[model samples]
Target: YFVGIIILPTVREMEGREGESEGGTSTATTIRRLEIEITEKRRVIKREQAQLQLLEQELEKARLQASKEAVIASQCVDEWGKPTQWDDTAHEVLKGVFKKKTFRLHQLEAIRAHLSGEDVFLVMPTGGGKSLCFQLPAVMPGHALTVVISPLLALMQDQVYQLDLVNVLAATLSSADDEYEKRRVFDHLRSMSNKGKQAPSPFLLYLTPEMVVKSKELLAALEAVYKAGNLSCIAIDEAHCVSTWGHEFRPDYRTVGQRVRSLFSSTPVICLTATATFDVIRDVASSMGLGQHRQGGGKKMATFRSAFDRPNLFFDVRYKPQSNKDQLNALLQTVQDCTEKFGSSCSGIIYCLSVKDVEGVAVHLREHDVQAVEYHAKMEVGARKRNFELWMKGHVRVVVATIAFGMGINKEDVRFVIHTTPARSISNYYQEAR
Candidate 1:
């Protein structure tokens, strides 16, 4: 009886303990579910926060774009409240001698718009008459001045020379020119701006970015001219330098947009580049604050492409052993053959990979009884000027240069361009070739 009594109490106690354990397990399961729900809620909040930040950024971008569009729209209107058209005389002059190409329509339209005080970006090919877009406007009445910012002094000089041929009063400011000469040029410009002048001054002024950035006097003079309402437009030649990816990176080019804005807010800016990829175009437009103007209805800028194909020329690539003397002789022989067949009037360019090569090749050509000249960055200004003048006047038949010969050069009759080595990139090749 005693054993039965002890066993029965123990069994009852074990049953009660099992019931308490089950209750505790159920409470722990409820706590785990609550913790899981809290974690999910935190994740959802974080996702929403990220989305909000993205939306904010997008909204800011949209606002900036809208403001730019509004400004452009306001400025594009004519005095009579209509989309402007080119002047009949201007149109006739442009279309008469100028051959009609793919961009002719766009060019005419751009000229008209620019004359009416609207900024434009003409992204045309190298030989696509980009200069005419601004050149024609520069000649128009009431358009007081067109300041062209070129990357190189040689280019500025070449442009000025070409403009002079057409009886356009054009002046260029470069480091090559002396201080006295610069002062004289500045004085002449001031005289032209005088309301009582008999013969008006040059409509176009070409300057390098370095001249503008480094000289406080030039900047002041430009500001004064702008205040007098003589500055009508600012043209950036070879504008791709604004992009870091461009073969030439000019820090001065980056300051051009701000300079335009500060000095001549009413004056329109025209950016011209020969070769630019889509990404490069976007980068340039962004760096120059042209992103909004380039975009249309929230879309990317439209690129104007002419035939990049040069059908008249043949393309060939050759890999030869490293024999400098043999290569030079062979190149000269080929040039002679081409000249003999194509006649003495056929002009060509010979590119060297380095200044040393340029000098060496030029000397060899001279020794071999060829009228050749060397052009590189290291040459003194007087030497470069003399060399360029000799080449322009047909005194020299060939120029051996270090890839700096042909930029903004107006020599249209160049029949051939020989490369000692392959160009650094296709853009460079096309630039030199064109």
Candidate 2:
């Protein structure tokens, strides 16, 4: 009787423990289900946040477009898209597209003459908004196409990129482009020609002087647009390149004027340059065939010239160290000092005479833990482009490059520039420095 009593109690205790484990498993299953639901909710929240950001970006773009249209609607434009009057139309573009509150000296005057279908020769100091004179007209509605003939491919590329940022349609044709890029530009032109004035907006086409003078395919395409009366105006940037007396003369630039005259004689031509002497200006005017001004018969070319005075830039000359080690140390010191004074984002240019010098300086700076890049004609195309972009984006604080590298540099806040060799000419130096 005693043995039966002990065994019966032990069996009851075991049965009680099994009941508790079954209840514990039920609670764990519920907790696991709740965790899964929470994970799914988090995914939904993340996806919705991503969609919200995209919608916000689209809304911002639409807002800017609506504002631009409102400004354009208030201005008066002729059938050909030329401003019927100067002040309101030009000022609207200045504020709407360029985001400037007012016009600089002579900027409005130059635009007025060009938009009024007259030849314009504009000479403004660097950063004087010379480009705005022509660029603003090109963006006007129904303005058709404005052909920009530039001396360097770099300038063409830079301008095209900048115009795109402002929602302006701009394209470039050059040897630097691949076959697909060339075809795309040509196809866009053909499409624009087909639409005529009904085309969505005005287009700016940038080309090197050689492309205008030599490319038969481009010539044929441009001819089609010209015949349709869609070729509005032609702009020659850095026009001094056409003059043999100018500091940087290119023979191909000489033929570009002849091509323009033969094909688009009725189209108004606007030539712009930063620094040109009287002799250079006269040669540019004559060579560019500025109508009666060349033959002393028709309407005189409108001239807008500004003084070359930059009161903000200070110039100092320092003797280079005799030893290479000392030279590099001095350069490193200069860069470090500028960095200390201007902060890490300070951008600078160091001009060297030779490819070897550029490479050496860039490498030395890198070894010293400075973010530096080298650019020269001798570098591979992709490498040159990559290094240039790094400098442009401020990923690299300094660029050691050849003297030719600054022609199309669009950076506005460069803190310092160093020249390892003497400038080729005073005008050349001024152009590069400015």
Tell me the tens digit of each residue's lDDT in model 1 across 1-434: 45554435588898899889998998999999999999999999999999999999999987887566445433432322344555665655554524332335256556666665555666666677788888877876566778999887667777777777767778888787888878887996676555544545437888888887788888877887777667777888887877777776778877765566556655667777777655566677666555243224232222333335656777666555468778888888878877897788766788988999899989998898888998888998779878987887778888889866666577766666888888777778888877
**Whole-model Cα lDDT per candidate?**
0.72, 0.80
Candidate 1, residue 23: lDDT: 83
Question: On a 0 to 100 scale, what is the lDDT of residue 334 in model 1?
Answer: 75
lDDT of 1: 0.72
Clashing pairs in 2: none
Q: Per-residue lDDT tens digits of candidate 2, residues 168-200?
A: 889888877779989999988787666435653
Candidate number with greatest lDDT: 2
Model 1 segments more than 4 A misplaced: 1-85, 92-105, 192-200, 291-305
Q: What shift in Å separates residue 191 of candidate 1 from its native position after superposition? A: 2.8
C-alpha TM-score for every candidate? 0.73, 0.77
- Give me the runs in candidate 2 sitting further than 4 Å from their true place: 1-84, 195-197, 293-297
Worst 10 residues of 1 by lDDT: 294-303
